[model samples]
Target: MLEYVKTILQKVSFNAYLFERELKKGMRYLMPTELEEFKDWCYATFGMSHQPILNRYFRPAY
Candidate 1:
């Protein structure tokens, strides 16, 4: 899990916009609830707020 996270972080480069966009794209195959839970987990683990991150990069209807 740590290695997976490290790989994601390495790919996203700490840029919240890019990270949010990539996460959204990557999670598209998941159920909505699962995606929400995943987002929450990411927020807790990475010390980032979900709203701000999502709001910054994810447009509505996505």
Candidate 2:
């Protein structure tokens, strides 16, 4: 699921709205244990282009 999401995210990276939508959708299907790893990969891969979107979704709960 994580790899599949990564692939989708990469494919949709051209559109911020689509990327964010897919990111949200992808997060839904990930296991709690996979979230940390997924978050790390998202930042590493999309940080330059979509830090705001990633940050919004990956923010720590207060």
- C-alpha TM-scores of all predictions: 0.47, 0.94
Determine the backbone clash count of candidate 1: 0
What lDDT score goes with residue 22 in model 1?
63
33 Cα displacement, candidate 1 (Å): 4.4
Which one is best on lDDT?
2
Compared with the true structure, the alpha-carbon lDDT of candidate 2 equals: 0.95
Tens digit of per-residue lDDT, candidate 2, span 1-62: 99999999999999999999999999999999999999999999999999989889988779
RMSD of candidates 1 onward, in order: 5.3, 1.2
Quickly count the clashes in candidate 2. 0
Q: Extract clashing residue pairs from model 1.
A: none
* Model 1 poorest 10 in a row by lDDT: 1-10
